[model samples]
Target: MRTSRARFWAAVALAAATVPSGLACIWDGDTLAAEVRHRGYLVLDALTGRFDRLPPEYYRKRYELASERIAKDPSALAAYDNAAVACERLGRTDEAIDWMLKKQAAMEALPVHDRAARDDARYRFHANIGTFYAHRWVAGGAKRDDPDALAALDHLTKCMAINPEAHFGREVVQLGMIEWLNSERKQSLGDHLAERVMSSVPYAMDSSNNVLAEGLAGLVLLGAAWESVDVYNCMAHTLNFSFDSSLSFVAALRVEELLQSGKRPLDQSEGWRITLDDAASFWEDQYKKRYRTELTKVYSQLRAAGDEYVRKRNEYVLARLAEGRHPDSDGGFWSDWTEPARVELPDRRALTRSQFALVQTLLAGGILAGVVILILVASRVSRSRKRAR
Candidate 1:
């Protein structure tokens, strides 16, 4: 690792000092930052860990604090929500679930006379519970008959009744995933990623990534399906297949990993019944047939940028998202399930006689002014050029 780091830094330094001037124009900050995000998969995984999460104790304390709030005041609804969040951070999913249920039960027991208010009130609880339930099922195991998965569907259905367009109707897309998985791969939640070539196109049409792509590729469940070709194919379909995305490379690399060795440990297995190494040839054949993207070229580009690019890109993108392009601009790994409705422009007024005349006069004057400015600028620039020549 130390030698790799030494070599990596040496390469970066040498490249920075030696790369052509024209290359500067090509590898702009945005491009470099975007490149490093997929850094581990694209080039090298040896760089920094800027995106590393906080320690579990931090989350445990957060949950405990929220729990304390509930102990002091059973009516502290916000505490219930906070506890769920803390549990999520702690990866204590079952506890996360318990908090949500407690929140719902407390909410139901609250003295609100109006039934409409009560139903409307049910929206958030249902939504949160549904999402957490889906999350639980995903991480627990990709079991077909998982009750948590089914329960999520029920809660989300109720949520949809109260508000059809909640969370950009994210629940609906999640439902598609659930239904698809439940049918044991009979359903189609998303499509294939294809490349166009003059002669042959593999994995064609399919608009690989949709709004739904983020689900399977997220931190939790995706790693477990590392050896499953079908899962890889589904991920290829499910993830928004950005040509530049590292996650996209991972789907392709899944086959390679299987070919290398499918002999993964069970008690300490990260995920998998087995490594599927026995079926490596089948996987390699599958990779040749499906994941046809030539990664060598991609590797060259990413290496040219260097491994330290990870920290640089993550920081840059996070700053960007934090500054503006977040919350909605970029479709995220998380929710945009429903976005805030776009506010419409105000209706145009019918022009009165005075309004029409004023509008015509302003337009005429503006055009005349523009013409004069254009003429003056053009004349000066033309004369200067002629003299220089």
Candidate 2:
């Protein structure tokens, strides 16, 4: 009888363990299906711009389903992420932030063996949260002391610290934009942000210092579009080129467009209204413009820079070969070279206080003079009518 009791208790314990595991699998499957359904709705909305076509209750239902599943399984990070996105779309910013924070906590709980994957996930989450705050700040009319702006700066800083090399190009451009937007409110912070972005140029160039010369060229074009003379000068100083060689060639073409059209290629006000195809066509047209003979002098300098880079690269490779090591092994070539020093930027031209005051005074005076003339004309008409009567 005692032996029978022991066997029964053991069977009960086994069943208890198996039941929860089975239920967990079922819950996960449901959550995944819900996520897939949510994504389908997103795609439909994107194509048709018919987010309202779905009943108002549909999103609530979906959110509820995900939330319930998340309550049961705290590790449902994807569900939490989807829930956060839905909340944001529904105009529930605080709820969205809460969901994102929960998702982040779940990610942090990942085992040590998953460190690499966790870091990558953490970087993405931080960057995305930063973007959300940035959008909110813009929506709020971009106040200097806006909490959203501060949050964005903090999150983006965390993202940079985690993986500076992952998306250097895009991140640097974003930083520049943020700094420009907020400079009036916090001059020191904006200046510091710009300096940090400028510092990344050398690392980006170094990473691209191979036969393809790919990295530095794109970064230069991006910097030029952002109107960063530091980036332009860095390219010039490092490459000994004029303005028409390598990636600078593309930037020079853009400069020509700016001078001719008096419009920036990328308009900030339009935001996401400009399509990718439109951007591509604009670039294609720029590429097809007749090469300006004036740029030839700049091209000559660029060629010199290119030649010098090649000479240095070859000498470094040969040295590595002499040392009985592979030339490209672990990026040994040019690894010891020092990055270019920061160049002094030219002072920007602005109207003095007196000049600004003079312009305003002239504008006000013009309006007042026009009003006085109208009044005198009316008085004359009234007197002429009275005399006729």
Candidate 3:
């Protein structure tokens, strides 16, 4: 590290001192201040902590350094951005928001002649707000009704509208909206909305610092299609078991048609369509084969309980009818099957526990293998370096 730092500083000095025809200092005061501020940031981080964890002092120093840089270079966009991110990383949500808002305010204060700069700044403002809202939503204190979740969606939408192909922001916003919709129990609406958003995804779209738009668009479309299948599956399961109405055949046919379709939408996302077909096939196979046992059990249990309730209801009605009174409007069987209707909903947690356990075991094993491989590779690299020296 010392050797590398010495060499880096040597290069920096050479660049700073060199001039073709006595041109003034290459790095002006603002640039020098920016360089010093970056070094201070590195030193602050070292003094505070290491990767994956940071003491409050680390963040405090980082924020102070960035703030100083912003003060020196009032148009320093990165300084404000870094300060805002550092504040968020330090768990200072309000401070982060304030810094970001100030960054936007400063950019807006710039002259109207700089229209392009203003536009860029406006995009950043909406994008950062969208990012913050998404983080808050995932952090889970905010419920479905939380205005922050809505605000996040709104910000992201605005960002995309400002620059319709902001692949990165659009992807995050779409995912956030999907999650928010799921949390709000508006799964159907989410599915349809996701479908629309995905349909408009640019094929070669590349987000800054990432190649995610195409891949994520594929995933979102596939997920929405499968979600549609799941909705029908659930409906079929409910009707088949609860009401003795057979909708599985119809649902299966619809899912099959979707899987088999070679229409424009499906052709547009062939990569995703293949995976979607696999899921649909899996569900359809379950319906054709495995569904019988589960549906049979559920139906038998429900039907038996329902029959008992009906029997008691009929008995009560007949007894009433036999009495010197009519069993019509006043003595209907509506009051009879209350007990069966009150049966608790199946506990999804309990139902999924075994599957969750299996997934956890697989994940733990995979992580352990990864750690061992990383250690071996690191050791091999260390030995190679030593030999080279």
Best prediction by lDDT: 1
Task: Give the per-residue lDDT digits (tens) of candidate 1, residues 1-389.
Answer: 23322433333223223211220000111222333443323212211112223344444555666778789998776667667766765667787778888988888678988777667557666766776787788788858878988998798778766765333224444555566666554222232111101011111111221222332332212112333454443343222122223333434344344445763321221222112222122234545323334343443444344334434544544554444443222456223322222212111113333443344345446666777999999999999999999
Which portions of model 2 show Cα errors greater than 4 Å?
Answer: 1-72, 82-95, 108-113, 185-194, 206-289, 292-389
Better by TM-score, candidate 3 or 1: 1
- List TM-score per model, in order: 0.42, 0.38, 0.37
RMSD of 3: 26.0
Q: Which of 1 and 3 is the better model by lDDT? A: 1
Sort by TM-score, best first: what order? 1, 2, 3
Give the winner by TM-score: 1
**Candidate 3 lDDT tens digits, 23-136:** 000011122232332231221111111111223444455567688888898777756766776676676666777877888778766767777766766666776666576566
Count of residue pairs whose backbone atoms collide, per candidate: 8, 4, 0
CA RMSD of all predictions: 22.4, 27.4, 26.0
Q: Residue 191 of model 3: what lDDT?
A: 31
Residue 151's lDDT in candidate 1 = 92
Cα lDDT of all candidates, in order? 0.44, 0.43, 0.42
